[model samples]
Target: MADTTTGSTEQSTVPRWRIVGPGLVVAATGVGAADLVATLIAGQKFGYTLLWCVVVGCVMKIVLVEGAGRYSLATGRTIFEGWRSLGAWTTWYFGPYIVIWGFVYGAAAMAGTGLALAGLLGGLSVTWWGILSGLLGLVLVWSGRYGVFEKVLAAFVGIMFVTMVGAALLTLPNLGELLTGLAPRIPDGGLVNTLALAGGVGGTITLAAYGYWLREKGWDTPSYMRVMRIDNSVAYVVTGLFVLATLVVGAELLYSTSVAIESGDQGLVDLGVVLQDRYGEWAGKLFLLGFWAAAMSSLVGVWNGVSLMFADFMTNLRGGTSEDPDARAGGKWYKAYILWLTFPPMVMLFLGKPVWLILAYGVLGAFFMPFLAITLLWLLNTDRVPREWRNKLHSNVLMVLCALAFLALCVNEVRKAVVGA
Candidate 1:
């Protein structure tokens, strides 16, 4: 099959601990500084009252990612290929989406990395740091292969795991409260935070890119199904814990004082200052480093992963035959999109984001998660995939829940963008 990996079926028997492939890539890519701020703001606002949403969000991503991986393995096709099979309308939606989302997200991701660096080293302006970060991401992914990219991303995840969780521990969470947080509850006026926690934070276009990463990792066939499940489950569980740790910091450190942070990415920078004031300088410096790692990882991951998706999209749009993502990993289209992600968006850094562009980015960005959930429901439940590999009842239920949740989030995102709220 065009999509089959070169690896043998026996490879799946390797121990679960050794199975940390595309799952980690997807997870790290999904959790950027914006996600941290979202969770941090949630913690600031509602304390642990919305903690259950973290677990729910993790499971939601797991199901969506697993369904995406399963479709690829079972059908020996890419997710883009699966989407194409649905109809030309899928192409219409995806074309505009990938273009606009890439343009806006490139600038946002670059600026995020720059913000962390500016916090870490007070010498350079954020605009220069942001431009450098984009250039750095381009340099990192422009040449390296998948294995090298994965290893770099793993290092970033290590920094993310230690620093965020360390901050949580520093706050000395209330054990009783931590336990109580596991119960589902929503505070007053927390409806948006509740939905954002469940659907938005630590997830986005990267979840669907799981399949592309799988192909790159040589887990491209159904024989690796068990391993894929293990990878997906373990990665998101870690992400959930990381988020829980962020909430702990919010609830234990900031919530009690009723401190307010500047909205958006500046909120995380505000956190570094608090850490410095309360725990001394090392804690603050470490958190800043971790923040840089998180932002840079997302930047690099998108530089690689989304470019792969765009490559596949372009190839399919040209009526090209099915091709393995790894086969075209750094091909012309991949390189072109990488350049697009790196350079053109830099203008936004200096001139500031245009209101219309921001609106398009928000509305389109909000629509994507629900789009993936609904389409996966369509693709996996039908004869499009083999009956044995089709979504089981539990899978169907989780995906339905994901669709509904994200749809609510979609409405909220659009409303907020439209009104500048």
Candidate 2:
């Protein structure tokens, strides 16, 4: 494992193509089951009319993540460290948020993986499969080797790329309509859905994890900025393709057939069955395999990534800096959060989730993306980041739009949570 605090990979000399590790991790982690369903449902409802929003969403993520990576390399501080520099309020918000988010998200990720697996291998029920999935994720990330972790995630991305893109090709998308979808026009009554497709799908807390992965990969200094940008751009380009292919599948197959999938992760399992009925059992099975890969990639990525963030949070809160041994990969704090994300959530798999916790998770989780965007706008523009690395005019513009869009989405999320409660 590359030491997070020590070691160097020659940033300038390394070929451009080789600088593609961390971004893949973020992309795979961010575009999980819920994201897939959001895009899938969008395509089913509006066909390709919402395709432009997918492009907008990709650019928004790239901007925010690049700001995060740039701040890390330029200031040589973790994102949590940068946040702490602002005020004590940052600590108060993040400390509780990470705890609650991990508890609920753990069960959600596990159930998503279990759903796909249950459809594929029916011996175990979804609850048992979910427990098994959580255990497997725990084991895989326990080693805390970023290299091994990245490789495993890449393999999942390969499966996702092949299966998803193949399904899109199988549907034979109409070239004229596909091209026309590029024009930005909202269908009547699609405003909320458009906002969601633009800012919600393919986005998550993992965007801020880019810097942590970059550090683990030995790209901690400003010299790595060029490659960091390249890595982010290229990885999200592939992610953009993945999202587009998914929307293509929805538009061509589901829309044309007037078919609608059940919402949530189960929608994906339902799609697999549709593939089986439309094509063959093999097509459906392969799609389910892709679905599992997507879910597991997210599970493992968060297992590794957010645990790193939580380690930093704990270290900082305790007066230790980011370089503290407990804050680094495989350290005590890192492993502690991994346990938090894995084991406690199993109780929810069998016993129902407590209402108070769900309410907390919903309210807190709703604010995160907007919080991230607005904070990046504040952090990158300030003197904390080196002058050369501070956000440019266009970067600031995009981030402002990101902040506003996410704020709207956050309001919608909070409303749903409140209504459900």
**Which candidate tops lDDT?**
2
Q: Model 2 segments beyond 4 Å from truth? A: 1-9
Would you give me the overall lDDT of model 2?
A: 0.89
Clashing pairs in 1: none
Candidate 2 vs. true structure, TM-score: 0.96
* Runs with alpha carbons beyond 4 Å of true place in candidate 1: 1-9, 12-17, 324-327
